[model samples]
Target chain A: MEAPDSNIAIAAAGWHFLCERAEILVLRVSREGAILHANRHAVELTGIPLEGEPLEHIFLGFADGPVGRRLLDRTGETHLANIRTANGLPETLYFTALPAGDEMVLFGQTDAQEQVRLRKEVLALNHEMGNLSRELTQKNAELAWLNAQKTQFLGMATHDLRKPAGLILSYAEMLEEEASGTLREDHLHLLDTIRASAERMKRVIEDFLDVAMIESGKLNLDMGVAAIEELVKSPLLLVSKSASRRGVVVTTDLAPAGQRLRVDGQKLEQVITNLLSNAVEQSPDGATVQVGSRRHGDGIRFFVTDAGKGFSEEVRGRLFTAFAGTGGQKRDGERSIGLGLAISRRIVEAHGGTMMAESPPGKGATVGFILPAQCLAPMRSDEQNGGVR
Target chain B: MSEQPGSDPRVDSVYDRYLASLLEGERTECTSVVEGLRAGEVPLRSLYVDLFQRALYQVGDLWEQNRVSVATEHLATAITERMVALVEPGVFGGEARRRVIVVACVADEYHQLGGRMAADLFELHGWRAYFLGANTPHSSLLDLIEKTKPDLVGLSLSIYFNLPSLLAALDAVRAAHPDLPIIVGGQAFRWGGEESLRRYEGVTLVKTVDDLERIATGHGSP
Candidate 1:
């Protein structure tokens, strides 16, 4: 071998140093396609040692072939390759190969123009997303405002109609009392129909008021301590009267009979009233409606079971939705307004409780609510002695 | 620019950390920093102007001075965009006033974060803000105005080179809705364009989020 010139050697060393520090990737591979050396940039970019590895390992989308040899054959032509980077993402790089002595040298650089195009596309997509998001936000605001307006209108209309409904109910009751003995049989039956219609109307109006208040986010509660047994028994008085008229028996099984909890006494009584009424309305003639309360998982669970045709899965799903009309017919063929259960559930939820309904096929249905332990207020002497004030 | 009211001094360090993470493309770290500030109850306006806006400006400056590569600046911008979106849920809360404003970037103006932040500020002040994102065409903008019947329109301009496009958009809006109010602002106004904006009537140049807030709440004119 001839001795290399010192000046040529020095220039070669300087070029080697430049290649090592270059921002682009530089690699020297053997003829067989195994990497002989990788520059600093190449190692740093890939975050792996490159010596003695096949050059194809760094590039993606190569078939089972000698990729390095083919690239070496195309000496000065640029080939686009996606180089796997350290960050677990592929980066597209343009590469050129050159024959050097008994090996091939590769240089890789990022395609700036391609990057610019990609950046533009990404920015456009991002802008589209942002515009859609803005539209959605605006639409949501409009819908909320419209809903508020509807709720306000509902509240006002219900408030105004409630007065007329009460007047009709009062007049019907007064006429029923004053003309019970003097009227003819048919006349008395007509008077009874009028009273029944007025009572139904009053119930429907009251349910509407409850729904309106709940929808307007104004379901205020006047919280007080009450015994669970008293709460259960108070509504039974009103419910038993209607149940007996249908030949349905009303019963109660309050286990923790003396259990006292903090709740809105009036609202809790309304919930019991709603549940018992619904049970009585759905019960078959001579069937029984049972009300029960017991300790359940650090809470008190109250449930009403009725011997009526069970609800299907579909009806059970929306049983507590207002105006869902899942409420069955009474013995007199009078339909319920379907807002009682919904309002009852809302009242229970306001007291930090949850409502549920279970109906087995060919069996009866049971609707229940559980008030959390947070509602279990210590019984004051006055509340205990005065029977749940 | 004056510091925004409710700006916390603690956010200065958070801004530095966020800018560093953004420039390095560490998205998770940036998210953590932003979430931390939000959890600490740093006011939304301060998060926008003090942290996000200030860091982006610094990143732009770094690119101008050649201290950072253009790719790094763009990475910072992309991260900041995500961070801004992270703050959006907090932006749309509170009761909405019955006013509506349509915000858009002028044609060929792609830097839209500032305008987006401004729209969010309006939302915070209870005005329903509809943001039409970057490079919005004049015709489409006019069509939206016709459809939405907005009470006000806002145009954003980022680069000074887009001043002509902004002016064209302004003229299109003015010709269509003669009595409609308009507000214009962005980094482009920092260099110039405010004087040119004076040619149109009922067009105000809002310079800060506070100014936008005052205008949105009907307390001050822009």
Candidate 2:
């Protein structure tokens, strides 16, 4: 054979350098699928020594018989293979194998068009997520502002209405005192009805004010030490009067009578009163309304049980939600304004306690609260003065 | 490269550590560096410009010099994108002002970090910034503008070759809403698109996070 010209030799060397330095994978493999050599780009991509290893080592899953023989059988045809890259991710590369005696030379490059499509898809999805996040933030801010406005409106309306309800109750009492002898029996009954309605209106207004204060995060607790029995029985006196009117019998099962808890006496009494009141209203005429307290799980549990139709699952789910009315008609046919349980739960939570409700179908409903052991700890000076504010 | 003005040497050390981790594609280390800076109370602007922007610019230069592969550069970008998101709760914690801004990369422009950072800066400064991510179609952008009625529009272009697309987006936005104020920025302007941008009456060019801050504070133009 004649010797090649000097120019052709230099050009051939330049082409070899270009091929070695290019951003493509170049591999020389034996017919048995063992890699004979790999160029610099291939070594960098795989981040491993390739020479003398099986060609299948670089592929994610190369079990199509012998990869080298398969590629050699269809020389000059492009094949797609997923190569394991240094990033622990698989990359799809288009490979073309050329036969060279007993060895197969494989050239591989990424499919740029497919990559561009995938990039677009990913970018679009990320953008959608970002937009949704921004919208959520905006909506949350708006909702917070609207809630503040609603609470403010409720506070003002209830405050303004409280004075009138009180005046009506006072005037009705004054009429009964000043004109009792001159007024007919039926006329005195009218005065009694007016007084009762005004009293009910005043209670509803007070409930609304409590809800407003709680919603606005101002439900401060006047923390003090008190016996659990005293906490349960003090509220029972007030609720018992109303229970007897509805032909319901109020009973107490007070255990741990001497057990003391650091709690707000007035607020806890109000919670007990609310729960007992709800039980009395929910029970059938002559049904038993049971109030009880016991030691429970490093805390104390107080419960009110009523012998009435239990709540359905749907109503039970939202039983403590403000304004979710008790899903049954009261024996007196009076509907609650529905803030009692909600306010009671918040008051318990402020004292580091939790509230609960249980209703078994056709049996009875039990509403209760558990004051955690933390409430038993002596109050810090700040908590004693400012309560749980 | 010039050091970022008012850059803290401590943050510079952090930047160096972060850059080294980023170049090596050590994602966990990079995340730790970013989280550490945030925990140490490094200002968000300084983190964005001095650490993230500075390191990414260096990576881009390294890619140009063939010292690092494209895959490594992309991995660095991906990691930095996640780090940016890690700081989002703080970014969006500011009390939102009544002003709103719409930000998007021009059509065919896939590099969205600059625009996203701009949107975050706007949010940090109390403006309600809505970011439409990479490769935003013109029609969808116009539809959003119509729906949101933003006080300002921002367009970002990262590749210099996409200058025409940026111009086309600006023209489409201007023709649709002539009086709407527009702010344009990104790596594409580093080469030379600012002169062409001056043709529009209400358009402004912002070069850095500080420049965007100036505009957000009603002090910057051109």
Candidate 3:
């Protein structure tokens, strides 16, 4: 245990520090493939006796080929190999060999267990995701099927309900006309209520069906060229009774008297009727509801202005939605399903037109829609510029 | 082949044709479009969403802008309603599950289309669906519920202003039959968002037909 020579001790200490601090498998082999030197880890990993065993003999258990020949023939070659431990357990290692004087020096690191586990997890996750995606596709198909069923059912309901409601209204009207003089005022009132109720029900059914049909892409329009007088007078005539009932004076102002529009007369009438009805309903007993139509730009602009409580900013924001007029009640105390304006806007837009509402608070409100000079496109072969040509 | 007006998927072209046909009062062409779509294997759901919904929305936009008249709008709607008959056979073919489902709009709520759609969805799920259209009297609705003893009840409120009526309907139903499952839908719920659904416990807010299917199937109840 006496202290070795200072030079020898220093060299020995340096060799030991280099081997342990490398943190990599370090091996030295002779030109003949004999094991010349090995670090602690290399020896432990390969389980070969240091400085004596032939590298070929040590790697015989796991190397794919003669490792000694492969390493000797190829300098600075990097490769992966399964090297066996003392107990014959296999651990994968990657290494690169470089010429070190007359011998070959190999440096490597064993593939860690964490990396292996992570790789397995990734593969499993990919498989799981595949299954999930397939399941999602299947669920979407099922959902689509259910949706189709729902649409169909709605169409059927609307159809079935509409006939009965229409029949009820028609019958009520017939009974009223047939028994007009014989019926008492109270009886007439009851009949009127029944008729009104049936009419309202019919409208509701029709609106429901219309929305369904439009949503299903089944709505169709008949386009025609009509005089501005007809467009203004038609809807006015429809709303005249309602206007007179509320004691609201009805007036009309049409500019450029003979100006005609190439439009859908029926749809345009509905739009006018809705605006006029709304206007008449909002007007006070003696207030006037004015209907006007004019040639504006390349289109006909029709408006119904009523001296009634104007729309608040909040109500205006949602005026075109399905539930229009829901934010506030009209002056007539009448409630709306809010579908009229929504439906009207869609009709005008379908005709390549626009609809709007304007009001100066306490100055009454003006509701109107515009019909372009021409429908943007001919909807069908038979409708190809039927009159516009 | 030239694309049919309502058959264009990119936009409202197909709906345009349909709307035009209705505007022209061409019943045969309108009916043909629906028949052709079905024969071509166009999914009914797509017809509803793409063709019908898009066209109707466009029609609404046009009418709102004063581009079309109320008469034309009504005609277009009327034609679309008739076209539903073309697909009626396929929609009402499911086996009856013996479960009654009642759908209705609240009192003073005149928008009954959403409820009608819900009722149909329930019926499609094999439930016996009863659609009490807009403004069902509270007493009658209660009586109908009692007589029918529906397994589920669906209520639709299209306008948010009708939330009070919805609440009233809910209270009436809940008082009459505690623990009954209720599902609510419509633009109102969507406009109000999730925070609105929180006002009532045990009432589920469903946005789409698919969501309604899930509820009817009992996979996603409130």
Candidate 4:
């Protein structure tokens, strides 16, 4: 005869609901003794209803082949061979039991819902990993492309510099030969052309070199004591012929602006030269270009004023941008690819000073730069300023 | 260390920005402000109207200092406009106030961000604002005012050059609508709102968002 109904039945009904609601399931078998009872896990697991049917039919069903007999024949708790579901699902099941009177087994099938969720999670993680790998690969490819481009750029810039640099040296040679004697007036003109072209080439090469050095982190400036005279006279003397030809008058009142302090003299000369020559080119024929210097507190300020076609709002907008010259640009709407002002600007900045410009359209233009006066040699006021001493 | 996204060390730096400042167009500070806005820990609007706008006004002082250019000053202005647009959505959402008509002065005025700021503030506060672009024709402005009959007409001026036109715009509005309220704001009025507020005989001049609140809420000036 059957004993009074056990507390396991109430729990079995609750387990049924947990399974149906959220796709969950629970199986309760006696872990103490021989075959007590089985729950309705079979309704979903065995795919059949056996509300009061004998427990043996479904116990055999919960196991496949001879697995059930081996399990029942045992008395105390024993780990049965990983039992298989009837549908041939690949999962391992374990059972515990009691031997005396009516023993019991507790076992549960693997939750299909959990398996599906884990499968999706694993798939998503794998896809994300793959995407990261692809992105890394793409970045490496981009880096390689950029390196190659940089090499090509340097190669081309060097080649470009060589072509003009060779001409500049050869032109200087011709100028030296002509300067002594046996130079015709036309030869003088050709010499002028050579010098101008050489200057232009030198400007380009210098800019290319400066940019390269700056890019490679090798642009260390050497500061020294340079006279204000050298900075003003050198560029003026170099561009003298061009100024004369263009009918532009370049006047300088160097007049010992300040104490020669610690500074990079060569680059300072280059800056003043660039500002003056650029002014000469932009000014109309027969215009006045004035260059002056004055002590500005701890620094000296240099100004180059050109009385030519002043900068328009358009040109002023793009003035400091490299390769954007002011002359043929306004006339033919053409711009230069030269690095004149760009190199000058870079050099000035390297010396720990600032450069600025003032160009009111139709009022001509003035370019100014300030350098600390600690780098220049002190000026002699005697003969230089009309021999007062 | 938290890294700001667009700030690449390999690219342009603070020195480059400084050089840009000494010459014409925008200073490095303009781009830095944009960078700050993009990072977005605090509301960009409050930061802008509070700090950035004051900083930009200092830039205007630099313009008066004889070293800076109109290009430089205007560049900062243009960049601030972009900043305003960038932060607008996060502060006010994407929905625009389609009903209110935003009235601004003519193009010769050339400066109207102060007006645009009010418009943005109004939009954030939940009124549909229609911007009358810049330097619009008088006939068109009046016609739009008549057609739209905006709940409020917000007038902005940033330069003294546009004062005559601003007054004319105000007068036209008065002739057109007797009951409709008008609010004026901008930089040209040095005393902020105190002087301009008293000066506007027939219109209301709001110095800031604080003053604008009273006018916007219908308790307009006498």
For DockQ, the strongest prediction is 1
Worst window of 10 by summed lDDT in candidate 1 chain B: B1-10
Per-residue lDDT over A86-198 for candidate 2, one digit per residue giving the tens place of the 0 to 100 score: 88888888999988888888989988898878875765676566556655665666577678888999999999999999999999999999989999999999999999899
Per-residue lDDT of model 4, residues B128-196, tens digit only: 555664565677777778777787787778776667777777777777787777777777776343453
lDDT of 3 by residue, B31-126 (tens): 877787788777665565555545555665687799988656555654554464355445554443578888778887755545654565565566
Name the 10 consecutive residues with the lowest summed lDDT in model 2 chain B: B88-97
lDDT tens per residue, model 2, B162-192: 9999999999999999999999999888898
Candidates in order, TM-scores: namely: 0.78, 0.77, 0.40, 0.36
**Candidate 2's iRMSD:** 3.4
Cα lDDT tens digits for candidate 4, A1-389: 43446557766666567546433223333432223334555456555454444434554344355554555556455553443345866444455444433444444445567756765455445433433343344345446557556645864687677776877767677666757377788877777677756765665566666666655556677777656766677889977998899788888887455445467777777778878877887788888899988777767778899886666677665665564664345222435464666666677777766777887767888887777544444445543776421
Candidate 1 vs 3: which has more lDDT:
1
**Model 3 chain A weakest 10-residue run by lDDT:** A126-135
Which lDDT tens digits does candidate 1 get at residues A129-171? 8667666765666677787777788788879988888888788
Residue A299 lDDT (model 2): 79
Question: Candidate 1 vs candidate 3: which has greater DockQ?
Answer: 1
Chain A vs native chain A, TM-score per candidate: 0.77, 0.78, 0.57, 0.50
In model 3, the runs with Cα more than 4 Å from the true position are A1-151, A180-185, A324-334, A373-389, B1-222
**Cα DockQ of the candidate 2 complex:** 0.24
lDDT, candidate 2, at A127: 57
Worst 10-residue lDDT window, candidate 4 chain B: B1-10
What is residue A276's positional error in candidate 2, in angstroms? Answer: 1.9
